[model samples]
Target: MRAAAAEHGLTLDDERDLTPYLDLRRPRDRFIAALVGAGRPLPLRGEYWRMLRGGDALQWCLLNGLLNYRVLYFRPAAG
Candidate 1:
């Protein structure tokens, strides 16, 4: 991902420094990958930003539903 971002003149170093704005879950990475695939800028809170930036209220609701599910059922348990 870093290499790909660099090819486009975007420095992934920003990501490292912005980690505190992220959700600290693997699914957040998936969401960022989705946004990158869509040719959008990386959001400040990653998936949370994506949902907030949805084209309509319905899309926002749907993405939030999915994110809720991931948080409830898929996020790894803390060790």
Candidate 2:
């Protein structure tokens, strides 16, 4: 990707760098609500986060340990 961008004489910055500006209004409000209501991370998915914030936002929250995610493992048993 860097090579491709360089070929076109374009300089690129990582999208992650821009994540800090993501609409944290919801996240902040929710975080406070969670503290007051449950005292835990509001359990949600990246999709919902995106819908609430916007594309490419909230990544910093996740990366910076301000948020977290879950991994679901499944198996098709005895195929």
TM-scores of the candidates in the order shown: 0.19, 0.24
lDDT of 1 by residue, 1-79 (tens): 5556556555532222332343432565556546645655544556765564453343344446533222111222233
lDDT for every model? 0.45, 0.48
lDDT of 1 at 7: 62
Q: What shift in Å separates residue 42 of candidate 2 from its native position after superposition?
A: 19
Poorly placed runs, candidate 1 (over 4 Å): 1-25, 40-79
Q: Top TM-score: which candidate number?
A: 2
TM-score of 1: 0.19
lDDT of 1: 0.45
Model 2 residue 18 CA deviation in Å: 1.4
Give candidates' CA RMSD values in order. 17.3, 15.6
